[model samples]
Target: MMHRVAGAPLAFAALRSQLEVPGDFAPAVRAEAAQSAQTVELPPEDATDVPFVTIDPAGSRDLDQALHIAASGDGHLVSYAIADVAAFVRPGGEIDSEAHRRGETLYFPDTRVPLHPPELSEGAASLLPNQVRPAVLWRIELSGDGSVRSVDVRRAKVRSTAQLDYDGVQAGLDRGTLPDPIAALPDVGRARLALARKRHAINLALPEQSVTGDGAGGWVLALRTTLPVEQYNAEISLLTGMCAAQVMLDGGIGILRTVPPPDKGAVQSLRRAARALGISWPDGAPAGDVLDSVDRSDPRHVAFIEHAVALLRGSGYTPFNGAPPSQPLHSGIAAPYAHVTAPLRRLVDRYGSEICLALRAGIAVPDWVRVALPELPEEMQKADHLAHEVDRAVVDATEAWLLRDRVGDVFPAVVIDADERAGTVVLDSPAVRARCAGADLPVGERIQVRLVTADVDQREVRFERADSSQL
Candidate 1:
């Protein structure tokens, strides 16, 4: 189910150069990171006895989090440890200045532009298995119903007992051989999912298109479906973020990841699309509920889910000092959330983690952190924009390369979106989504589309309706 595209490496290299992506770290930053990696002191509090394990994609070096869950009475006790990037990067120091300039890690199919030098991000500061590293530990006690009863976060020295990947963990769970450290994940994850449904949170089960190496020096484009264990792991992270957001709100100062509620007009449009697609929408069901009911195996259902993506818009970081912002909820999550779980990859998480730790310890927020809060949102926004551009451009170019030899061939596709004269289509064979041009393209319907143009240099791929094309 994967298609190998030729000449992708050269095309991607040219694209990166054109984007002016940052290269290796500056010499001063590298030297500072190397020294700090060797000499940084571990926190006094030791949680190394806790058997924490990390779950991420295979071969991920810059690990950010490790977790262990256990039964606490009828509920569960979750011990989450996040990499403490601040331990090695001093305020206004070389590494810190370089990280601020980078904003966040930029990921491409071939490689990544790390936020910090490898000496720290991939070495000392990473939560690699058996390594005693500094961490921001979150100890959360949850009720039987999965509601958080109490939360605490602080610095500590911790060690990960194992490094797990999603596929392996899910396989272990399926065989009833999962380790004890995270055996409670399914129970807690199911409970939390019930709560999310009750709160009308949107959970889109859409397959993501990704490009990877084919091992023979070519690029393969494929669709990756989310495994059940991945959802459970994500729920744990969400719980911590919600807890952090509450702590910051109580302290009256911090930044929040916020999104406005879906617009009424957009909701109506989605309802109309559902009707056109022959999907049922009850009188009182929320969009999330309606989406959850759809069978993802159906092509029409996939198209409808793609259309619902429009409901999530206007998301941005909201920084506040004295009073909390008017809108603080991440509508997709149906709760207030903060970015404090991935400090190694994201610049904002380090600052957010520092604020939460200071508030919990009853100490004044550091002046350096306070002064940087206002500018953090803009910096993160720019980084986010760049990341999106890179991902989209890379995919577009790869898709173009995949279809370069079949410009006149017609392929079966689903019209996921439409306007008066143009729309978007998803082809299943190659797992590609690109712009389609024709008159009155039907949305959420299977149709034949002919590839008209596939230009790797421009990262453009276009199709025309088979019936409308003159050939």
Candidate 2:
């Protein structure tokens, strides 16, 4: 089942109009920000001194996480300093209410509505390089096989020494001459890389595209996770988040980003899809595991991954105010998980971090967090819907524009979805699903087809069989 439904018709102009502040829309999170807007005293820059760097987009204002690696007793320890948004925004205050209402930072190709105001998100709480800021640090110890041995989270102040981008990191990692700190920790990097390959061996290989700021005129659609280091860095964050979730759940209360296991019927459908694509599977393995293996080995794995995407459906925000719920873990991550990082971009993380902090301190979970727990699910759902709509609209529009003039051109495409009765086929690249125009197309098959028509104005692309020579 396709759980990610088609987006509603909410135009960018309308959402922009709604997000406009009312001239005095909670200028700062508190009066302290107003008092020393010029030169506020900040935390020590020891973290920044140790070659801590930020790895985000080209022109991101609110940097959320920074990393620093140092030698430990036997191995290396990773100090991950995340922006402490929970400290700045008071619970139930005006700014807090606004953040809660917003629920998350919604990003579109043309516009973005940040979760917190710029003074805090882009200034005080941001982990900008060379600027010391308060941070909630997670110190994790990693074994040689990439297993996390010990984990610690606490309130601390830190700075980021350098800011790095994905492209730069990829280039450095490839050339084997990365800058000082990142280059110094070869074992840590190797462990992280090994861990990433281990994860990809089991996790679903889904592709993601991010619309980046073009800087000159508009935005450009770029596929994320193309580089190996992208996956490596993501695994670090995931390790921390899973550890935090475990800490909270073990203490008897915590919210989870939960997705129920794929249904047996859904798994069976995927298995049939594999057979249709001429891929073999073991006798009694789990569907997810089989799909992961096929994705790694099969030539048509791109299309197969698309089909496997349908198996895991309906992910949602589940709050555990009183006790943790009995549910299967997220099959994609291959572990139980929750969102504790990126508090600057997400509202739930602020409260979630507070819960974790209190639990670690052996104190009762704050009443504010407990009382706000039930409302979190619905709020997060709304924000998620809004974000998805924005993303799909932008990508759909861009692809339509790119293919507007090449209507009759033929290109190799991996089949994402197909319907025999409707004569429909969806391509993986450009993500345009269209009708086959009077013929049946098999699902999970790859072929070259001509674009019969493309209407950029209508956001529609149509396809047909090309000549024998071309096909």
Best by TM-score: 1
List clashing residue pairs in candidate 1: none
C-alpha lDDT score of every prediction, in listed order? 0.91, 0.69
The candidate 2 region of ten consecutive residues with least summed lDDT is 1-10
Residue range 1-471, candidate 2, lDDT tens digits: 011212323244654444442222455444544443345444443444455788887678889988876666667688888888866766777678888778788776555678877777788789887887878788888776667889888777787888888888888888997766555344675675566455532467565655544555544555444566676677767877788888878888888888777788887887887788777778876665566456543336656677777666888877775567888266567677888889989988887787787888789988998899888989999888777766666565555665676777886654556665434454545555566653456555666778877665555667775657755
Clashing pairs in 2: none
Highest lDDT model number = 1
Each candidate's TM vs. the true structure? 0.98, 0.84
Error of 1 at 446 (Å): 1.4
Give the Cα RMSD of candidate 2.
Answer: 5.3
Question: Residue 458 lDDT in model 2?
Answer: 58
